[model samples]
Target: MTDSVGFDFARLSPRDRYKLLIGTVVPRPIAWVTTVDPEGRPNAAPYSFFNCLSADPAIVALGIEFRPDGAPKDTGRNIRASGCFTVNIVSDALVEAMNVCAVPFPPEVDELERAGLALVPGVAVASPRIAAAPAALECRLHSFLEIGNSREIVLGEVVHAHLRADAVDDRLHVDPAVLDAVGRMGGHGYARTRDRFDLPTMSLAEFTARTDASDA
Candidate 1:
C-alpha cells in the first residue's frame, strides 16, 4: 500500500472540513430531540453532536449549529426560549420517524405528528417525550457554551427518564438486540447496534494467575 500526503485542514474551508469529518466518523449516535416553542408548538430535530456528558447528575449535551446567516436553528431557539427539551434515543425501528424530524419544516409544523410518534408528558419539564423511543431523557437547560457564529453546545440535566419495560433489567444492563439502536454514519449512511460482543475485564491478580496457569 502507498502512503498518501496529508491535506491541511486550515487551508480547506470550515464547511469542507466539517463535511469531511462528519462523513468519516462512522456510526454516530443520533439524538432525536423534542422541544416546544413559546406558543406551545412542538418541534423535533435530529442532531449527531450529542452524548451523555455526565451520569450522576444525568447531563446530556448537544452541539447545535447555526443557520448560514449566523442565526440559531429552530431547536436551539426553542430550547433557549423554553429551557427544556427531551433527548430520545433512535432505534432501527424508528429511523424513518427520526428522519421525519430532520425535515426543515416551518416553525408551526409539528414533527412528532408528522412522524406519527406518540408523546408522553414529561414529569419535571413541560416538554413531552417521544413514546416510540425505548429511552427518553427529559432535560432542563443547565448552561450553554457558545462556540462560534451560530454554534452552541447545550448542556442539560436529565430531570426525568423513561425506559421501555423490555429494554432494561434489574442490573440496568440494556439488551442491545432488543433495543436495535441506530447510529449515524456520515452522509445518508447509518448503522445498527445489533452487532455486539462482550469483553470482560480482569483484575491484576487474575491476569497473573491466568498467565501462570498458561505457563504451567
Candidate 2:
C-alpha cells in the first residue's frame, strides 16, 4: 500500500477542517430534529452530525453549530429551553422537505409549515414529529456540553420511538428497504439506503475454518 497524505487539523482553519471531515465521512445519517419554543411553536431542522450514541440508555447526540453571529440556533435554543425534542428519521421521500427546514429561517418562523410537512404530536415530549418520517424518537435532554464557541453537543435520552408499522417487525428489526432512509453525503450529495449488503458476524471457530480453507 502507498503512504497516504496527511494534514494537521490543528493548523487548518475551522472551515477547512469541517470541509475535510464532512468530505471524508462518506454518508452520515440526517437527524430531522423537532423542537418547540416556550410558547409551544414548532421548529424543525436537519443536522448531519447526529447519531445514536448508546443503546442501553437510548442516547442520541447532536452536534449543533452556533450561528455565524455567535448565537445559538433556534433548534438548539428551543431544546435548551424545553429540555426535550424529537428526532425524526429522514427518508428519501422527505429529503426535499428536510432541506426546506434546513433553510436559515428566523426564530419566529415555523419551518415545518414552510416545508409543508405534516406534524404528529410527540407522546413523551412537547415537540412534535414529522408525520412523513419513517421513524421518530422522543428524547429528553440528558446533558448539554459546550465544546467551543462554534458548537454545542446535545445528549438526549430517548423515551419513546414511533416506527412506521410496516417498516418494523415483531422482533423490532427494521427493514431498511421499507424505511428507504436518506443520508447526507459531502457537498450537495445525498445517498440512498437501497444499495445495501449484509455481512453476518463470524465466530472464532468459523474464522479459523475460513482461514484453514484459504490456506488449503
Candidate 3:
C-alpha cells in the first residue's frame, strides 16, 4: 500500500486549508456568475467554488468569499439586492474572457464589457446571461448561509436554462464535445473537458455472470 499524509483541518490556518482543499479537488466547475445592481449596472465574476446541489429544486450553490476588508463582494451584494443572478458556463473559448472577469475591478466597472463579452436579457430574471456562453442558468435566491465572517454559501434555485441549440438534442441531452467547458484547477491552472471516458454500471446479475465466466 502507498503511504498517506494527512493534516487535521482544525489545526490548520484558513489559507493553508484552502490551499490543501483546492489543490486536491481536481478540476472544479467554474460559475461565471452575472448579476445587476439595484441601479441596473451589470456585474460579472468567475467563481470555481460552485456546483449544482439539488436537481429536484434545481438548486446551485456558490461559495463566495468576503472582501479582505470584510465587505461583501459586488456579486454577493447584487444578488442580495436583486434576488436573482445568472450562471454562465465557461467554455474553452471563454476561458480568457472569464479570467478577465476575475480581475479585481471596482464595483462600478462592467466586467463583461471590459472582457468584450456580449449579454442576452434574462427571460425569468433581471440579471443578464452571457451571450457567448454554451449554457446559462437563470436563478433566484433560495437561501444564504453566512459561514463565519469570511465566506458565504449562496443557494440559488434554477428557474430556467438556456443552452446553445447545437449543444442539446431533442431529448435535451447535452453533447459534452460541443459544450467544451473549462474547469478551474489549483492556483493559475485550468483544465479542459475534452479528454473523457465512460464506464457503465453493472447489475448484480451481470456481475455474477462475469465472475462465473471468469472462474470457468
In TM-score terms, candidate 1 sits at 0.90
How well is each residue in 1-216 modelled by candidate 2, as lDDT tens digits? 999999999999999999999999979999999999999899999999998999999999999999999999998999989999999999888888999999998888878888998899989889999998989999999999988999999999999999999999999999998789999889898999899988999999999999999999
Best by lDDT: 3
How far does residue 205 in candidate 2 sit from its true spot (Å)?
0.9
Estimate the overall C-alpha local distance difference test score of candidate 3: 0.95
TM-score of 2: 0.98
Q: What is the lDDT of residue 207 in candidate 3?
A: 99
Candidate 2's C-alpha runs over 4 A off are none
TM-score of model 3 relative to the true fold? 0.97
For model 3, state the Cα shift of residue 152 in Å. Answer: 0.2
Global lDDT of each candidate: 0.88, 0.92, 0.95
RMSD of each: 2.3, 0.9, 1.0
Cα displacement (angstroms), candidate 2, residue 117, comes to 1.2
Please provide TM-scores, in order, for all candidate models, with all chains considered together.
Answer: 0.90, 0.98, 0.97
The local lDDT score (0 to 100) that residue 76 gets in candidate 2 is 92
Whole-structure CA lDDT of model 1? 0.88
